[model samples]
Target: MSIILTVRRIDIEETLNTTPSVLPQIKMTAQLNEDRIWIDGCFDFVHHGHACAMLQARRTSNNKENSMLFCGVHNDAAIEYNKGTLPVMNAPERYAHARSIRWCSAVVEDAPYVTAPEWMDRFGCQYVIHGDDVTLDANGEDCYTIMRKMNRFKMVKRTYGVSTTDIIHRILTHNTLPSTDKDYFPTLDELEFCSKGVDGFSNHCYVFQDDLNNMLVRGGYDWDSTNSVLILGDFDLFHMGHIDQLKKIRNVLEPRRQIIIGVTSNESKEIIMTIKERVLSLLSCSFVDGVIIHPSKDTIENSSHDEKSKFSKVYNIDSPELVDGTVFSGYLTSRTIIARIETQRDMYVERNKRKGMPI
Candidate 1:
């Protein structure tokens, strides 16, 4: 969905109380008496993934008189660890974004870190919402321990690719410095950008892709991804739109989902000139882990499936050596889109997609 720009920063308390453009809308505690929902976070960037979560929360509410909806944001220090630098968007910006989403009835600058069970007990939140992606932490403890405490919890599984970290990356890629030398080899971002049919555009941390053929091995991951999702296309002539799609997919894939983008490699050199490039184009992005050719006979497929899944995924892509406008308008590759739920997450693949781009 294309964004229709509106006001950047506005006071929620002020708008709801005095602005003629806005109306007085108080937290409907009575309406939500039996239904107390909490969205936990510092929500530093407050981008698309946040929006997705809010959308899901609202969906469950159904504008019902019986449901009461609320959201909470973490204080500055709490958010910093997840986001690098100065938490790109501040508390005011974060509140402004959350307020715009009507699903959220209240906003509080919560403490730095509070476990789910603790928070639920403190707020009496009848239902705590989480995305399907939440899982066991490094210590082997499930991330949703508190929510699991009671059946009142609700987990929303939405399409991926909308995330704050992703928004940061898009902002960074939009401002990538001019190419310089070997460093100029295609960027994982560039390959990922091309993979999704390039916009003329554009993470952190904390996830393990150990299964060998992660979400990148196949396809179909929806979320503002920390994990990468692979998209295959000829991508001969890159443009702004192509860039945007990659940003969208990267953000929408599973969290920390690195991308493994595949650019078409012509079978005959007579059709195109030789260009020196790296195995992966985008190396600078914190999100993309690596890149690769459309999958070769020697590549290792995941342990989950015995068939050459990696090669099979690449085989579905349809491409030609030619670079033209029609490719983006409508393009395909000779490879298949592949994803593995467990095998080495899609992130490395996302990073490596940039391997073949011309400087």
Candidate 2:
């Protein structure tokens, strides 16, 4: 015997403008909710700038409690065709990067470079969000023109002082200034820009708190010492590799085990991002349950007993023991990212120069 299933077709128009009388049942039964917001990008380098856009979109929802921010990552072909250059990270890497963001509810892979209303409709996204900066296609037309014409577009402030271009510029120039140097560190305003919409840590605290002193930034989840796992690392640049490692830890560990991240405040000359920036980056990850900002080597060893007793299992990512074989060995590390730019130094320098960025 064979069984047949009948699926109900939902009218997109009715769902968008549903009244109490018209398709009231359909509204409640619809798989896609009205609070879904769409944001698409190449997300080549996956920096705080991309994270901020998604955060702003989630904050803009009509019902914050139930809002779902769907992130659409464009494929390599689309990026190459529209931007005249292939993305530094491939599509799978880009998708994984977007998936790790705390604000992203879902990841849509292989999205078109140009925003299509049909694609947005298919996801039942009420509005399409993007940064204020204009994105143009190959023919010099606005990428979001279709969404703008339909009045289903929303714009958030573009994060300044940081971009893939700027990162590439720094790599090409080998600008590894000390984190304490005023010129090297991001300004208070720029730091606060990325810290906004973070749940547990206040923007002021996140920006002004001295990482040299020990501090803990808790996630939105409540602490439960009985069911927690501690992982420590510098987490500089917070790329897909970090996300993959966190995912593996989650998979291997017991279900519902909270993964707390311990970020070392190492002022090493090799460190690219500051401790605060690193903390913010880790906090933005969906897998991270909390972040503990600990002082360098000896200081951590001398930490108070009360702080030390919180976790039953501790895994140092720099030298993992518990999840030895499960650790990710991907090519998405900060070193490799810098190397990618270093290998293509002239190309990146010329790209930044064309964008009017200081060489």
Candidate 3:
């Protein structure tokens, strides 16, 4: 597998002269003591990789619990100008998706494509965080050069094996229907790698009965008996459609009722992302309180009644309760995304090739 990594050499003198500093010295000095960090990106097709970056960014602060991560999503025009293509999702949608992540304290929409020291100061962020991969501007220069000069830039390891390009490639190559024959489950090593930044945080990922029971014994799910709204689905890609549904559910439900998601394991279904990946994606959502890894259909049908009574309302992806009445729904499912790629296979294939994916 090809790893995403980039190293850029910068001329300090040139960068300092070219990059404009808009923040007053007094304001900059005053904000230096804040625990806020800024992370900006064109978070199209937001996935686990983006979530991992947010988690790692949150860890940069001296006090993890008190740290605030201000996430910034670039607007459509900026993304198009810099990347040569409009994002899969628009600015508002991307902003909403980024805001859903558990680690994000605030979301800044219409952020500049290039990281600006003034923008960081505007948010009172002590540092700006990004993955190791180099993001270039329309001028073919490192977008973070200015921040690097200001000594306000931080780098996190890029999560290998997944990206929006790779996902689009998968959709182009694979059938939309779920396949039980294909071994798409992640390896133990990969799981361990993704679990790295989550060490000191609350344990949100869980397996079925056995694992969940162990977690409960360790005080993972303290509201097991609470009245909650239950939502179940494959949540394969876990994109904007899923986020919109969760947001709607949260709006309709009482504030005191927790929203728990039951992610169906991939043992019997065809899913693009593994169960652990799905759990991590769901846990990042602001509306999601807990995730329960449930067995396949037969097992779910046979689950004890005591387990069923814990939820006052239950909804699946197909439930009318979650759907907004419209011919053109804002929701985008994994299948819908796959169909989109399939419809434009040649274009996506070329796009992935340009991104250095082996085609």
Candidate 4:
């Protein structure tokens, strides 16, 4: 048999200077070398918007010799300090992800416990670039002074500042809002009406602000342990996972504030729900003040039912009336409604329902 020969060619364009070397990973920075603009961040959740930010930075820097982006990984401690948790992806993983981008020139692991001052001093960075959405003065007054003095700092506008947290919340809400961490809040007053007048937007979502502090005005009825106000949303399929999220929020405001989670209605086209189970899910948490439902028909105007207890307010945000038209039938609802939830989690829930489960 004649021997068959096959040759495979591989092209390695740039250098892999920092990684797969040793322990105590290095702290590296992307510079405006003779030719390229370097973009750096934890880049934990690489996204479409992130890609755009990199592209814009590259164009702005106009590095002739380096036509690519440089990303820097912060040490584990750095990530925890800044983002309040450990990184979703580790160093080596982040390094490889950054390098995979066609625009990226290199990826390196940053040293642990290194401050920006130490980094600037070590890298002798000609210039440091970042996404516009990132806070320039995150460290403190001293950081501003350092960057100002070095004159090596640069920022590119972030076309999409959408964060990883936002993405996660959307996924959770859509797929696991009720089941993720379900908690029930009792209501001071509960009422049922098969009919509701379309409440037009009175823009009644009011936030209570004092001279020095801001607090939510909740009509606490059932919660005794935590004098706090309770706020829940479209808590479909109510599960312990959801309880985890609600309880965390409650713990801070607890004894001061607990939550009265509003279950989403499946009646209208405007409010999409999760699981789409014909049966309504029930919440069973002692900390929960009570559960309440929205009126199918109304006093469309967000008129306060003064005769009824004060706990009545909008429940589901997915309801069109909450964001749009209001009740005009000689009824008026308070412009200040307190159904607060973490903005990030709220976004997550909306995204989840659409993918399949329904929030």
TM-score of each: 0.38, 0.78, 0.78, 0.39
Q: Write candidate 2's Cα lDDT for 1-359 as tens digits.
A: 11111222223222322221232233232233447788999998787778878888888765745566767789999998888778777787787778778777667777888988766665567689999899999999999988898888999998775688766766677675565666544445544444444331233223223232433332234445447666777787777777777877776654478776767655454676666557656656766665556634433343434653445666766454433454243445678777777787777777788788767
Full-model lDDT for every candidate: 0.38, 0.65, 0.65, 0.37
Question: What 10-residue stretch in candidate 1 is worst by lDDT?
Answer: 333-342
Give the runs in model 4 whose Cα sits over 4 Å from its true position: 1-13, 17-36, 63-68, 111-124, 134-145, 175-359
lDDT of 3 by residue, 82-157 (tens): 8877777667668778876767766766788998776676656768899999899989999999889988889999
Model 2 lDDT, residue 16, Cα: 22
Give the winner by TM-score: 1 or 2. Answer: 2
List model 4 lDDT by residue over 1-359, tens digit each: 11111111111123342233431234434332423333456665444344445545545544434243445566556766754455544555455544544344455467332225444333333455655443422353232344546675676665432355544444344333342332122111111110001111011111121110122332223323223232435443232334334444444424454344444444432221232211112221323443334322322222434424233333333233232332221121111101122334454354444434345
Cα lDDT for residue 244, candidate 3: 73
Per-residue lDDT value at 261 in model 1: 45
* Residue-level error in angstroms, candidate 3, position 229: 3.2
Which 10-residue window in model 3 sums to the lowest lDDT?
1-10
Once model 3 is optimally superposed onto the true structure by TM-score, how far is the C-alpha of residue 31 displaced, in angstroms? Answer: 2.6
lDDT of 3: 0.65
